[model samples]
Target: MQHAIHPAYGPVVFRDKAADFAFLTRSTLGSDRTVEWEDGRTYPVVDVEISSASHPFHTGTARVLDAAGRVERFEWRYGREAA
Candidate 1:
């Protein structure tokens, strides 16, 4: 490890807007936005689109894509000769 060359790593807040969830963790990424955490301390807040709280895979809400149906629909729509 080199001195004065590595990005500072400290506590940060990662917020998932969609799930309205937030958690505190260590990160090198800093932000100007700040938020008061449960411990009554302010930390840099980062807004994220998805996290374990709202992720389909983590929440077991993932849906299987209907690829066969999509292919059939596409064929029916474009594969028809000008009849």
Candidate 2:
């Protein structure tokens, strides 16, 4: 452990605008915005575009890529020549 060499780790809110989700957790991330939490305390707010709440994998909205279609498109653009 060292003194005056570590980042400030405290309660901060991660806000996902797309999903309208927010959660408070300890982090070393810096922010200038503040918000009143459910516990009646103010904490720094960090705006994030994507989080687990809105992420495709976590929310089961992930799109399956069509490999066959891509292969066909590629072949059409460039003649198939086995190297």
Candidate 3:
């Protein structure tokens, strides 16, 4: 909590463009972008690629990993001799 030593901690908007999602939270991160929120207040907007709203795992859209297929591919490439 030393003065002038730490980055400013304040409200920042994280925007997920793909899902059209945004949320306000306090953090040390920031961006040059700005956005007016529902409350009619402008906040620093940070664009993100994914968030809980768009993430496959969080939204139940996740694809099952093909573990067996990967194992077979690895075996094929390296052979069983590669223990």
lDDT values of the candidates? Answer: 0.95, 0.96, 0.93
Screening candidate 1 with a backbone cut-off below 3 angstroms (N, C-alpha, C), the clashing residue pairs are none
Candidate 2 runs further than 4 Å off = none
Which pairs of residues collide in candidate 3?
Answer: none
Ranking according to lDDT, highest score first: 2, 1, 3
* lDDT score of residue 18 within candidate 3: 97
> Which residue pairs in candidate 2 collide?
none
* lDDT for position 8 in model 1: 95
lDDT of 1 by residue, 1-83 (tens): 77999999999999999999999999999999999999999999999999999999999999999999999999998895666
| Per-residue lDDT of candidate 2, residues 1-83 (tens digit) | 98999999999999999999999999999798899999999999999999999999999989999999999999999979999
| Model 1 weakest 10-residue run by lDDT | 74-83
Per-model TM-score on C-alpha atoms: 0.76, 0.87, 0.80
- CA error at residue 61 for candidate 3, angstroms: 1.5
- lDDT of the structure predicted as candidate 1: 0.95
Instruction: At residue 48, give the lDDT of candidate 2.
Output: 95
